[model samples]
Target: MLDARLKEQLRQHLDKISQPVELVATLDAGQKSRDLHALLQEIAELSERVTLRTDGDEARTPSFAIRRPGEETGVIFAGIPLGHEFTSLVLALLQVGGHPPRVSDAQAQRIRALDEDLHFETYYSLSCQNCPDVVQALNLMAVLNPRVRHVAIDGALFQEEVSAREVMSVPAVFLNGEPFDQGRMTLDQILARVDSASTARETERLNAMSAFDVLVVGGGPAGAAAAIYAARKGVRTGLAAERLGGQVLDTQGIENLISVSHTLGPKLAADLEAHVRQYDVDLMDLQRAVALVPAQDASGLHEVRFESGACLRSKSVILATGARWREMGVPGEREYRGHGVAYCPHCDGPLFKGKRVAVIGGGNSGVEAAIDLAGMAAQVTLVEFMNELRADAVLQEKLRALPNVQVIRHAQTTRVEGDGSRVTGLTYKDRDTDAVHTLSLDGIFVQIGLVPNTEWLQGGAVELSGRGEIVTNAHGMTTVPGVFAAGDVTTVPYKQIVIAMGEGARAALGAFDHLIRR
Candidate 1:
């Protein structure tokens, strides 16, 4: 039934197909004509392939099978693969073609032996540029191992899926149908979690009873400083963190920190960790602090339990848990984050150097980031929800002096717009004038504010301020004796690295005083 000319063209296209290459095409049941059938036969005669069969009569049933050319895998969809679903089909073919991107051999072995089928539902918005690395890393792993299957649902495209999963943010990944990890995770960490889950039968939960003299809860600049100061005081200090660096690791540079004129957050955290390690501090990486309770026997000692069920008793505690960036909480804001939007100027600014950028927020952090980025980026637009900037006069003067920095006060971000891959610009509405404007930029830095990391200590003995910061006396003494707090977690007027380090030293001294007196 096919025309001779069309059949010859199909034969030629099929003849050109080579080994180690797989072709996947999506065909609709209603659109399958005689010409298309002849083309399919030509493809079958030329190479091995798999065809996905969809019932033209029955709308619900869609099945896949290996056709004559079983080597080439063709994906036929009952529905269109347009929008977000197209990428999934391409990734599947890439996996079947033996072009599994980049998984280590050891990780691959562990992944292949995984007995249970894994369903990874990654809820993401194309707008979230920061999440692609996480998605790409997981997809690469899935490709390497057949047992792993990653299904990425565009949170914005599929409203039902988003509400079902309670997807609050982009880059949120779920493993084995359960919410496993949030934010972002590297490839190595993903592999570790998979291996842990796969070999979970052989592992037993470790019991608590391991104790230390001083326990540091976080591993950021403040936490690392506390560990170093405490260890130097000759106390058996222990430091625990889910990641080596706290939020600071996301920063690109630190110009305000005394002694360090310029330093990347990750590098600074690494060096500080090295210094802490040199002093005999017991460092536990990839551990989450779950709870803090008073020790049973000791009056001043407190027990710290980790998510891993490992616990440690400490005579004193320094709550150096830092802050996290507050999101705009707008629709599609999470999806576009990291793609064209970011939270850390120091970390992602350099990547957009000489390009246009928008800094959202009017406080010190926002003004500071705008000023800093103006030096690197071609043009910097500062959007503030408040009427005026809360930054100090000196910083205000400095920001005003920069010709490239444009401050738009009393403006709120409405939505972020991007090409489903990265950010192109953003939309803002003027609160006073009710005027809306869209500005084109390479990146948008959300410097709105920071939320203190003190939720874990709630109902504990430690006193917290109205703003949720832990309360400490001038000497870093908490309301509870023998318990001390420091860094951003405490009610410190200024949140600076040097100030936190000073407070850490003071807390360590105070702990020593308590121990000696006891």
Candidate 2:
């Protein structure tokens, strides 16, 4: 199952197992089952503390459970967890074997103290980069709390279950057979969802925080750079964001970042967070800013309020809330977001394997998505509003070479059609002939562009552009005296990650200058 290099790495990782762990598999005579059996056998050979058995009674064939001998199983995998989930498999083994997880003591205690009998099942795809985080988080929770159990099912391998459950997205989590979440979620987010009182505890903690010298209102590349720069200047820095990694977390490949030839989005986001942590910055993840209140005088602190009613005061503020995926806004698109309409091609592409799908947009993202989907999807229709594709020449060439792909230029997506359960087709109109057409598809991927997350600042103190981006000066200072802006949320010409980081650094410096002048 595993190559020599992977087997050696697995052996080294499994060597850290401090307690005995058993792999009890229940598999049939199918090829997938045999493959899983061979994989399990190979895994059991990697470490002395690990053993394999075939006496389990799991209903799902080609599935296995990882647990201690004579103990109730807490972790299960319904398919071969290779690809992006290989790390998840390794972590599950280690955690179930009594090795400590890489979480804070309080987090670990919270997980262990959960008294509810929670059973989590996550339907994931092997190629999805976002699925591993959710899978690993649930797996860790299961390992920590005996009452909690998790089953990670590969949606592609279990098509009947995927179809029966109406799961068209990756990392779709169900709690005790009911829908819980539908996207990438961290351990803290999951805990908050399950533990209702966790939010109040967090709110109190946040409300008690002292005023900061520089407050960054986002956690993307821009916010991270600003926080790091401000903290390095020996100022009290605090960063609060809806999601720390922001849009970058949804990104797949990033080869254009300077000094780095190639890197993955999650890896780069982790590195950014780690770098910011090297400073004395207060990191507040998953906090969304609802309002920004500017100071009345030079001595007064600017206040930023969150959805939890927690307010944080700062001498200077940097707005870098970043952006989100631009939706099609057509009818039925919202109704079938998870059912069929997906924005992330890499995350949700596998669920539509051998099914017809459409890519809306003609930019690099759309072309790339079409190219990626052409390999798995039975038929891919690329719809473009422009007469010609705007993607790079190389990308356009590759997209045109795909046999199963059909390019539709000068077409506007008018509406998304679904059968209430899932997407069945789409409605579009030709710009030249004004003729309406429909496409039969199992999924639709919208990759037009991004919309700045500046709606919260609409009636705020800062000046905004026509497109809703915050207006900023050359020094990254906003219309407000002590407040600055940067990155995708601001009036920046480009929305690249490297440019965002540079703008964030500049905004941090500008805020520092304002503070010293005051």
Candidate of highest TM-score: 2
On residues 10-110, what C-alpha lDDT tens digit does candidate 1 reach at each position?
A: 44543443324332332344443333344334444543542423223321122122212344222222222223333443444444545444456866776
Whole-model Cα lDDT of every candidate shown, in order: 0.66, 0.93
lDDT per residue as tens, model 2, 1-518:
89999999999998899999999999888999999999999999999999999988887888999999999758999999999999999999998898888999989989988998999999999989899999999999988888999999999999999999999998899999999998999999999898878899999999999999999999999999999899999999999998888888888899999999999888888888889888899999879899999999889999999997789999999999999999989899999999999999999999999999999999999999999999999999999999999999999988878899999999999999999899999999999999999999999999999999988888867888898999999889998899999899988897999999999999999999998988
Residue 497's lDDT in candidate 1 = 76
Q: What is the lDDT of candidate 1?
A: 0.66
Could you tell me the TM-score of candidate 1?
0.59
Pairs of residues at least 3 apart in sequence or in different chains that clash in candidate 2: none
lDDT at residue 278 of model 1 (Cα atoms): 89
RMSD of 1: 12.3
TM-score of decoy 2: 0.99
